[model samples]
Target chain A: MFRSLLFVPGNNPSMLQNADIFMSDAIIFDLEDSVNLDEKDNARNLVETYLLTTKELPKAVVLRINPVNSDLVDDDLKLLQTRKIDYLLLPKANKISLFVLDKILKKIENKIELKPTKVICLIEETKSVIDIYELAKHERVEALMLGAEDLTSELEINRTTEGKELLYSRSRIIYAAISNKLIPIDTPFTDIDNQDGLIQDCKNALNLGMKAKTAIHPSQLETINEIFSPSQKAIKWAEAVLKKAKELNKGAFQFEGKMIDRPVLEKAKKIIEKAKLFELM
Target chain B: MWQAGSKESNDCLITLKKSDKTKIKIDSIVGHLFHNQILNAVKDTLKSDNINNVEVLVEDKGALDYTIRARLKVAIKRMMKDV
Candidate 1:
């Protein structure tokens, strides 16, 4: 239920400690792209030390590690051998890469006698799109994020705020994640200055049935969380539906000239649950 | 020893040069206002990492204790090239 996942640069100590103030649903300690090439070890060590010392991290903690093919991946995994990380985000994830990562994680878990760490895949390449179903089927896979920046770069297409270039990929990801029961997280808007564009983009993602998005800056967290959380109107509708469902007691019913069936009931209940979780109820 | 990090707002520049007789010498360019806060933390971290003999030069740019400690560890590791 991570509506907004904030990416905090692993190498930036101020940003790492700033997690206490930001209200992102989840915080991704990025050791991949955010860390400079020579400072990979430094970033990994910093994150490990932070986790070991910090007492109360409000948001869900995720570690975005280097790609499977990179030389730094081993040391990155070594950090997990001793630290408690809730999730491991594999950058540029594909079928082959995930298989390799799965093996590595398994070995680490065995050596450390630690519990399984949930896995998240970054779907940003065309090859990954072709094999997304397989990638989503990983036992540890719990979520998938669309990395539009890298995806567009690979496709040699320009990304637009309107999101025309990412329609197909977005749709495919939503479908795959839904079918596999994985959470679908959208990419960051990348335009830190244009608040209006970010709002429009988030609304579009919500319309496309995405439940979460990554935030590069903390300012975007509020907008993303507000968009993804169940609105008051939605909560009211859910409450009304529950009341009517209890009254009906059995079978489908007609409400507002629309069919109120089991699926609709389930959606209403989920909306209410989300509202309660966010303490909006 | 070796050096790591930069003089960025949230970072520190640590220079670890080899020393003799297992003696530790620490000099700071911006450790006055905080008194012995940054240097003390760096010293503790160095001891915990089993680094006893080195000349530690710290150029603090308002880095947190964690940043300063991490920079020192990297500098020592690069210097030793053993761990």
Candidate 2:
């Protein structure tokens, strides 16, 4: 349901309240890289108060806490326990093996003193993408986010308009996320003003199996939502597939001269769900 | 110059006239509106039991009015605990 997760900087107060007006399914109140080290405490304090006191937010509110090893992370975790945030977003989470992930879950539990059932919004940098399958297998992970900026920085490769550089990473993320039954969210398009670029990038990611995308600016939210949602054509195709499958009455059928089977039907159902999400009838 | 004035407990002043004086002055009405919302959100602390005076100044960067508001809210929320 969280097709668009917008990043509203934790230190920016007006952005937080304004975020509520959007139709995005999730809001990432960033307290990590978006915040300066000197402002971490201030950002954390504000985020806590906003969630507690502000007008009711519409979507799932998630706090991207500082890294686990950072001194700031302790206070971030402590503060989350007192807030209405739905997820404790963990960043720089590269190389998350089974044992390491379990350790993080345990630390979060101890720090926040929450149950093990509490899940993590896991963002994967380069090293983490290398071990994606193992990380996603952990029960504590709720969603897998591609941290392209960090990964690109780590790999020392420039990200192009086409996002061809991160294709492997994107594929790995989808594999892991699908295996874990978790949503795979793509990174934001850095060029805020390039609407056409954003649209194409979103389509590419959606085509590659990203269930949702993160938006850096509010202006980008509308387009991301539009590009990912099932279009009229997609809805028609899904409906046609369902109808064709029903007519066949067999497990396997044919559509557009291609084989349609149980898996195809499932995909069609997902498309239908997306259409519903878009209110496209 | 940025002015700080409080009319009510929940309302406070937060001004940010461009610190960089080299920049040209803006007369656009829309520009002011962008910073105004930011100032109101950050300085007001709407959830406070008390509502009072408010003022704020913002140095614009050709940003939309909404961006101004969002940034200001974070600043005010950060300072809320101390207030």
Top lDDT prediction, candidate number: 1
Q: What is the lDDT of residue A280 in candidate 2?
A: 72
Per-model DockQ against the true two-chain complex: 0.65, 0.06
Best by DockQ: 1
- DockQ for the candidate 2 complex? 0.06
Q: What would the per-residue lDDT of candidate 2 be over residues B1-83, giving only the tens digit for each residue?
A: 33222122222233423233322223223454554454444444433423233333544444333333334454444445445
TM-score of 1: 0.94
Residue A53 of model 1 has an lDDT of: 72
Q: Give the per-residue Cα lDDT of candidate 1 at A31.
A: 96
Task: Judge candidate 1 at residue B63 and give its lDDT.
Answer: 78
Q: List the candidates' TM-scores in order.
A: 0.94, 0.73
Label model 1 with its docking quality class: medium
In terms of docking quality, how is candidate 2 classified?
A: incorrect
lDDT of 2 by residue, A1-281 (tens): 67898888886655765768977878988998888887675567556766766666856887787776667766776665654777767787655333544575577668766766434545556668877787777666788889889788878899887989989999999988988798899999999999999998998998899989999988888888888787788789999999987788999877899999888899899989878866778
TM-score of structure candidate 2: 0.73
